[model samples]
Target: MTVAVGAPFRTVRELWPIAWPVILSGLVALFINGNDAFLLVGSSDKVLASAVAASAVQFVAAMVVTGLVGSSQVLISRAIGSGRRDRAARRADAGLWLGMWGGTGAGVLLVFAGPVLLWLLSGPAIDGDFARAYLTVTVAALPFVGLGSALRARLAGLAQARGLLFASIAAAAVDVAVAVVLNHMIGPFGVAIGTVAGSIANALVLAWFAVRRLPAPTGVRAPRATAVFGVSRGDLRDLLALGWPEAILYGASSGAAVVVAWLLSDGPAADLAASRILELTTSSIAWIVLTGIGTAATTLLGRSLGGGDLPAFRRILRHTLIVTLSVAAGIVVLGLLLYIPILGLFAPSSVREASVPVVWLAFAQVPLMALHVPVTAAVRAMKDTRTPMIASLIAEYAVFLPLGWVLTRVIVLGLTGVFIAHVVFWVVSVLIVGIRLIGRIRTPHTLV
Candidate 1:
């Protein structure tokens, strides 16, 4: 899973290989999630309402380990760039150990604490009982999601992202098939169980390939790769240092959706439904697609920096930014054009009225998102996740939520105000993150 980072990919051909698989995989993963909506279309608004909460809940909880294990990608890429495959192996080992244990703990906490957590996160957006049932059944998926993230990080670092795509396809297929079968037998909870099944399938497939293709290090002189938890304290610390901010960043993003639901709870039910549907669909597309681009940026920049190739990093960043912005623009246009039709297909008949008007705000976010996703990725690649995390906190708490509260609650502008605030949050975030990214790019390797 280690490849030397020599020259930057100079041609469009080289760039396509890194970007396409990750993008396709993101799309495939979306299909797995898309099942919750597509299959449950006939369900009531209460069940439909659970969609946002369930999605946010899984992401928020899973993000804890996902962010930590994600450090494996950073560390592994750097090691490969510097021609230290053994170090990459250690990083991968650390990721797996932490992902397993951390994922388990998160799952246990969420399952046991389901009622309270769902109460806060779901707000009045979803039926409390339905949310709990969904959350409880999907508890087992958390660990698999964590491990799958770790495995994905390694393949991404090694630039073998096609493996990740294969996993995603398998996961999506399993999810759809199981969901269909179980829905007939068991009713609404089928989708939740199917989600869990997909997670396991994804992790298992990734593990199978990893074991056979990415062999264990031999004739190596690091401590046995198996300590009590399979990695050394140093590697653990390294992961935490890089990962905590990623956790915070992702958690904040996920938690923001829940917060939005809470804000919309007191308003007209249609508004909340519209917002949630937009979040699960339109907004999800922007974030997911940008995430694929961000992955490419991370791998290229992480490896380039590790190899002490500043020029390569610069070029890679530029290429990433151009492609991300271009793709995001296309996504925004297509999403806007197809919003009503897509919503009609994906959501029940109840949501169309409130959704059509506010969906523009969701689409408006793509430009800002296109800006920050790669800029922040570049910052993270430089091993300074704190800056982006701090920026997100400032934007989310200081600006986004507070401004949203005022616009919606104090001013009574409803969903209009909420989406406006959402757009503004990214504007503020892009400025903050861009400044840090530029600084790090100029300095190279210096955390400051």
Candidate 2:
């Protein structure tokens, strides 16, 4: 369990024992999410636009929640790595407290912000109403989704991949069942509701396990939430240090995509649909490498560094990079090979032609984007989130959005241009993260 800084085991060899299960779980989760998205806008361009619009508000809520929830993973991973079981237990309790308040706050904010956000994202007349309805229902579920995030992060940091996987599979099945049934019955709104129900269910499952399996408080001690975990200045600082940047990066990325979507709103329906589908697929693959393996890397790296195993940490980093690169290449190949069929799943025949080109373009960029996960995760493992945040802002705001707007709106390359913009964005982000990681590697001291 105690690995040196330069542990001989390859990162893949080490990480696979933990990461593959997480990835499998993530795929199931991503598929459910993507399916819900597809259900909302499979046929109508306007509905698709609305779905994106609604998702914008949800994204903001997620960022805010993540700012709080993210702390749990870093702290818990450190505790676990150092074999501080009690501390890990305490942190898990803290995560629950954070989830309740943070999720509630985010939910309230979303309920109020939903209308304002929708209005801001409004395009043509038809799309506005659909967007409003979808956004409303989804945003209504903010508390559940936000809490779910906190729970998931805690479990992940504990290396409870199996539990997480089970929860995800259960959630996905329920969500899908509900979505299919409701989509037939109540239309797009039903799908959104079903998705929310799934999130709620997922949170419950995670909470149940965390409460039951973690160490119990002695009779002399107070309740877990009241006695063990409370918001503290230190906790806030630690959480904010890593979490804010991640939240900001995610918010910016999602926001940028929405902006680009708006820019090309007037393009052909097929093209727009294709762009959405591409985004969905890209997001799916991203979770597999970035979010999935990244979660594992973050936990492993955080733990190793916490235990003063700098060499082991570095080994983990190396292995993560190797695995990420392999996965990225795999995504590219899979993307290219499955282009027509994958796009077909989300688009009708009428839009298939235009969708194909945009999707292919998006697939071409998967490898670059894939490379970004390990670097970001590794840096986060070092508990230095500011660097990644600064890098993301520069890459996304300074480079990606501007170029996307130009290519898609001004230059009018339509979906294809949008795809190119995404590629450029990922390529730039990967480089930025890579450079930062190298700096960390060269530093004399190990960061925990």
Candidate 3:
């Protein structure tokens, strides 16, 4: 069954059509999530301040869950590809249980240790107090985020992208509406509570759908917090075996971002502000391209691996590279054309003076950023998690951080240098990871 490149329904083409909606849905969600900050900036100064603090806490919580429970995407995606529906169900159960325990642990730590965490990071006593209040409310909402991410990954693994997209859109709409009304009525604290409430609503909707869509067994009671979700011991072991490396990969990447943030925080006000602006822009685009391609890659490559078709798996990898390049070029061109307008949306006056170059430099790497996602994702699909983790770790620490340090500290380019460093980092990342992925695809493995 050799599929032609121009075939109408080939796996590669099929993923493209599905991926566009998923990517667009994710971008809309990001925009909606940022709505509170956007809308409240003009309301009251206090409301604006609170929105900033709360958004930080919410993002930190999201990063924690995203780095940890995101492994479910790879685990469940591979399980479905293997045609092990029973095992897939069990993996979902284990993931749910894991998310619960992980969320509980993090929530407890935030309750007890959050103040100290904020104090250490805030750079001043007054700032620490504000950060603490925000962290308090946001931490209280962690379980919902954790649970929702796990369920969403399960749904994605099932290839029910439309359902996931719809639920996400609904959730985003409710979040923005509720946050806006509350921000005007009850002030910034109201906005924070409204945001949490919205996430709770999203979780409830997804939980209902997940329960309905998931397979049921005759006599099994849902497992306890430790063992609940109907996951067996064997399934738990397998998921961890596959998921831990992916978790570390995400954690390392996020941790690097935080370090870079801290480094920039010590610079001049313009430098700090410029770095933050660059981050927001890069993050917005990165989530769309990386996350969409990663999900699509896991599904397609996992299926090929499960069907024992190495050639098919190889073809998917090559197609992913081609798709990445195409998307990357489009993003770069868009960035170049809209640099002034897009940067103006965030910091109109200062953008041209300080942030535009950084933003555009980050944009220039969109293709390289695209290369990173699908390649790493294909490795996960092949159950070769160690390779990606190792490669990403090397790229982040040995390549990204070191060069960024020199560019920002030693070089005279300031913010521009930081942006240049970002591009260089991604270029190096693509080369290293891309080569490794190519090697894996070329060397076939037998699954006896």
Candidate 4:
């Protein structure tokens, strides 16, 4: 994929070049993640629950790790769009620095605070030996999670999709191989070990590309390994300015999800496992597909705004919406078609019956799930991170949490109630950001 040189995307096909790699990369990682269910075939309900729960927590925490990647996306894309290659490289270095520090800090917290957080979020139901064992081993992946994500954001800004895809493939290979070997000997903890090994492999390769293999946009001298930690104060401020809102929003969202889990945990654990299965399975697929479109939107939007072309930015938004809606329909249809197989793969017999409808119910979220990614990307692309953050806060605290509490607690619907609340959350959250997005995308071709 070529970085935009102040020119707007001229056709829909242009997006495929930027979109496919990240989508493929996410799928590779997720496949290994989903394989956990396959690997533990004869496991008990609690073992199955612990496997999914610990993994879910790890995944959410990882998203929080990379959530601020928008900083690099906005900064380097703008610099590249403006033909300021040296500036783009410097901004990327700052992002790398931030990622390392943030990820390291997060890891420490997961180790020290994770148990407490677990107790608070899930109570007695989930505070068992297997879950704790999985988390303790998997926590080592924290730094790699951050470091790899930062390197990826930098590559994305430079439009180096192939590099990103290759790194993901490498990580997936190591993760799967390690998990397969270890699982035969150690069971559930093998998945945890695989995550750490794969993360380290992923980080190493991405670092190789960032420092040596990938060519920086010419104005900077080739970046050195040590340059990542040499970020200036100004660069830090710039990253934080565009990054914090989305970061905080993700953090809040993860917390909100855990509370929903707590509600489900209060009931039968099969119900909880069913909920987690739907989330890690269908929800993950939806996010990966939609996020491909969002990443494309971010790239196109950042370039158009950086080059001061308002009409082009709006055009990109229009194209993004068209693509998202079309893809959303396919996701729903595919989810319907695969419903039986998915339940077979991830749900134990205990969870299987409950999950039958939960799988169908999840499709209620596909449309809005698809829509929100690009809409939020559009808003964030204009560097208006705070508005989306505010919009999300309202969507969650004001609507999602209340609705979920009613459906699961007051109404006593259990797993089904949680899914219903999820559907409504996406609906409300999408609307708030979408209304704001409509106004911004209509302005003349320029940065908001």
* Predicted model with the maximum TM-score: 4
- Residue-wise lDDT of candidate 4 within 1-448, one digit each (tens)? 3645322335367677878998988888777667665566467655666666676676667767777754687788878778898788788888778778888888888888777656655544464567767878888887888888888888777777667788889998998899989988887788789889988988888888776767744344444567556778898789888778878777667655566666766777677667766776787788887887788678878887888878777778777787888888988998889777757764567777888877777887888877898888788778788777787788777887888888988999888888887778788888889888777655544345
Q: How many clashes in each structure? A: 0, 6, 1, 5
Question: Candidate 2 residues 1-448, lDDT tens each?
Answer: 5564445355656676568778877787777666655776655766766676676567667666765566678888887777787666556566666667777777777777777766775666227777777767776566776667777777777776666777788888888888889989988888888878788778777666566753342111111646224655565556656666777776676676566656666665556555656666764566565567778888888989889998778777777776777777777777678778766664678567766656666666766756788788788877777777777788778887789788877888877777777778778888888987887688838464
Off by over 4 Å in 1: 1-11, 121-125, 214-228, 444-448
Error of 2 at 217 (Å): 16
Clashes of 1: 0
Better model by TM-score, 1 or 3?
1
- Candidate 1 residue lDDT tens string, 14-60: 56676688888888987786678667766766666676566667767
Best by lDDT: 1
Per-candidate local distance difference test: 0.78, 0.70, 0.64, 0.76
- Stretch of 10 with least lDDT, candidate 4: 1-10
* Candidate 3 wrong stretches, greater than 4 Å: 1-4, 7-9, 36-61, 124-126, 185-187, 213-230, 268-274, 345-348, 410-413, 446-448
Candidate 3 or 2, higher lDDT: 2
lDDT of candidate 3 over 1-448, digit per residue (tens)? 4446464246556686557656866776676666655565444333333344445544654656655666666666666666677666677777787666666677787788766654544531124465567667767667777777777776667665654666677777777777778767866555566667767766676676666543342111222344444457787677677666766676566555444544454454455444544555664666576668668877777777776777777777777767777778877787778766866765535434776556657677677777788888777786777776777677778877778778777775667766676677677777777788777656666320
Q: List the residue pairs that clash in candidate 2.
A: 4-312, 5-310, 5-311, 5-312, 6-311, 11-319
